[model samples]
Target: MWSQTTDKQRNLERKKEQILTEIKAVQQLLKTEKTKERNVLSEIQDQNHKIKLSQDLIRNGQQQIALINRDVEKNQAEVAVLEKELKALKEDYAKTIVKSYKSRSSQSRIMFVLSSENFAQAYKRVQYMKQYANYRKKQGDEVREKSDALAVVIKSLEEKKVRQNVLLREAEVQKKNLEAERTKQQGLMALIQKDQRKYNDQIKKKRTETAAIDKQIQQLIREAIAEANRKAREAREAAAKAAGKKTGEKVVESSKGSNTAVFELTPEGKVVANSFKANQGRLPWPVSKGYISLRYGDQPHPVQKHLTIHNSGVEISTVVGTRARSVFQGEVLQVQVLSGNNKAVLIQHGDYITVYQNLSDVYVKKGDKVTLKQEIGVVNTNASGQTVLKFLLSHNTTIHNPQSWLSGSN
Candidate 1:
């Protein structure tokens, strides 16, 4: 039970550290954003994130305190039991010592052995005296061991108390900070609410733009799939000709249609597809350091509760000048320029595809092989001074949440 509690405490401490690091990053981003032209909605969102992190940090601290309290209570109980045992041991040892002192004379010891009915009895008496002396030594050792144990438990209890106090202080500080963030968020919210109509229009326009981009992306993916199937079909036909079989053989018949949206994988392509599928939920992040700013699918807008925002992919907010990296090794399928001069990189892992969008620049061209975590392009820092990488994952044209595929999503 004690070991389990200690493990829980250690885990909570680690979580607290992570929360603190996230809070620090949010603070730095907020500071940087403040230096630029202020976007009230963005500021509110960042402030809200910081507040959430602060609350997590405080809750983690409280949990740590709770574990420490459990430990302190357990140690105190142990100390009490050890003190009682030590006290009894010492009392018994003291009595033994006093009795031995009164009979400490060598003459008295010799008389003890001699007082027997016969020689056999006298030998038994001598053995009894030796055993008595050993018993006294054992009692003294017990007293010392118990004393040492009591001292150690007391020390441990003191240390736990100290840690508990420290966590309490830290939690208090976090609470204050959280309250301040909440106040600032309220102010930002008011400012946004005052111009809510303008902000809402802007958000709708942005959503329309994103929808168009998504449509373009889907079309590109379809084209890429068709191209891949065409190549596979060509290869099969060539092989059939080499074997003196008609080009209309059954093996080459599967890829005949132009409307085949899914990939017709070759043996090698099947291997890559299987490998990619096997690594689900363990793929690396598209960027080295960032937090998911916007998750996949439909979510309520941050400021406008009535408005719903649909995201085709997850948006990761990263530091400025951060380069987007490949999550896995794949062949670059397409590098297309989208609206606003932003670029998107699509890499194909067999039938699986990973997309990195909103890049300011591109590094790889079509059909180029890229390794895992290879830097592909710089993520664009938007007008609001936020550098975000919009990442998507899919099997053929079926979209999957990138967060679920990325490592440490839990």
Candidate 2:
């Protein structure tokens, strides 16, 4: 903002850019999100998606509008805050103006000059008069500057309200579009009935693949933990051997604690725990940017409301190839290829076990230590050719909702 000027302008421009970027990102997410994945998850996905889009629009508009309103209010508040100061200035200005008018009207600018008692005193009074005039001029200039700034702020507020109006209109369109999508999704569900056998097979394959992946992850983790423990043991023995030579006596283990951590809490549980333990309120974003599709617990599929299924994790919809990263530091217990052309990775953090399913590939193997915000794998796109992440946070083997841990990510 200020390649050439001051700090205030730079700070103002930085805030502007942050707000603008959020607005643009939300808009783009809405545009890029596809309709097919919503159908696959059932109407529940579609409804939530519509709601999310509306929320983003409303939120962005309201945020910007609020900032503008704050500016206007600040201007008004400033006027009030400085009223006493300005009042005194006004009195000084009034006296100066009155004196100047009389001195000029007398036509004997000379009589005014001769009114002085002595040469030094007369010279000093003239100088004082000129200084008072300049002070009055400065006060007038200040009032004008503040008034103009206030007007600009009010105008900006109007523009923000206008933008909010547009956002509302967009939200309505999104709602109607959501309704249309819901209806079409219902049709698709009916079609699923006709192809129930095929759909069931698909579901069965998905479950099998998931199970296989889970087993692989557990096995890999066990091996990795063992390996870590083994290495730690070797280091201890090595130190013992060195100490034995130095002191002529056998040495004991100095560092015996294992580096492994486990979060037995589900995603939601972990999120809650971490929220209190970490940021006090915020959760990390599971993926960089995406709309949540399936939420935690038993919810109807997007296509058929009658077809209820329990969701252990949230399915987040985003652009293809979007990488899934660790919301917090943890150890990789398992990574395996699941069905549906996807992979799954499980990590343990504290008492929390985070499970990220529906991945295209895994980056970390079993026993690998991953830090906060570490990339685990790219999200696997569904049949719709768009990335959909099945995110779960768990304690031990029990499921946790991904949303809680990623609350801060939003």
Candidate 3:
């Protein structure tokens, strides 16, 4: 029972620490200045992060309060049991004292033995007196022991109550903070709605930039697949020629009218591809902790209901300077630096490709081997002061939803 209570306390501490970290992250974001002029879009993004962190903190506070309540209840029950036991012990001890006092005289004890009819009877009478004295002594000791235990339990119960009260107060404070942040977010949204046209224009411009990035990524995947197939074909031809066999011309199949195509790999590449595919949904997250700001595929804009946004991958929002890591063990295929966007790292795990974009700098380069969860680069804090990573997954040339591949939860 004590171990379980201790475990709960430890878990509560961890959750509290996590809440603190998120609060700090929000504060950090607030401190950062957007690279571009302040606009509704940027303001909305910043406020959205603040609102998210506040909500998370509120949840943590709720959990903490619940844990404290359980502890308080357990301690109260323990106190009650101890009090009852102590009371019974005290009564038993008092009864023994009263009975002993009634026969307290040494002379009376001697008379009790002398009154026996025979020597054997007298000896038994003396032993009975001694046993009674011992019983009384034992009862007194037990009462003392139980009294001490009750005192300890009472102290513990008091402490638990104090802790519960503190937690309740903290939870109330967190609720207030969450409410305030939510109100602020609502105000920001209303302002954006007031200038709906401007907001829609900004969203359109962002969508255009996103489309451009997706195009570049798809093109890169296609080129890499073509190159891998070429190498494999050459290797096959060399082996055939060495065996004195006729090398018939065979062309790799292409997927026409599609941006993606299958990658033909050498024997070694096939093994890597197989391993990558086997992991599937078990892949680690690119960032240590973050939430998905934009999910894969087309979705309505947050501010403009009529506007639809297309995304090739999930956009994860994290604290500034958060390092983006490799989801799986792979070799870096390319390190691309966009005109406005910072940089992007493309990694190949067999025929599968993972892209990490919106990086401020690169820690790994082209052809460099990376291990699973290895830091690839730091995520960029954009002009709007939003630190986000645009992550994509693809097999050969076909794009896959990264959320399906990444481990569940933040």
Candidate that would win on lDDT: 1
Q: What's the TM-score of every candidate structure?
A: 0.95, 0.54, 0.81
Lowest summed lDDT across 10 adjacent residues in model 1 is found at 246-255
Write the residue-wise lDDT of candidate 1 on 1-410 in tens digits.
Answer: 87899789888878877777777777877887888888787777778778878878878888888888888888988998998898889999999999999999999988877777899989998898899899999998999899888888999999999988888888888889888888988888888888888999988988899999999999999998888778777777778777755454444345357544688887888899899888888999899887787889999976677889999899988888999999888899999999674899999999999999999989999999999999999999877788889999889999888888899764
**Model 3 lDDT on a 0 to 1 scale:** 0.79
Q: Candidate 2 residues 92-166, lDDT tens each?
A: 667877867776754465666689899997898778768866887887887666556656655655665675576
Residue 254 error for model 1, in Å? 7.6
Q: lDDT, candidate 3, residue 337?
A: 88
Each model's lDDT? 0.86, 0.62, 0.79
Please give the lDDT score for candidate 2: 0.62
Worst 10-residue lDDT window, candidate 2: 1-10
Query: Using TM-score as the measure, what is the rank order of every candidate, best first?
Result: 1, 3, 2
Would you list the rank order by lDDT, best first? 1, 3, 2
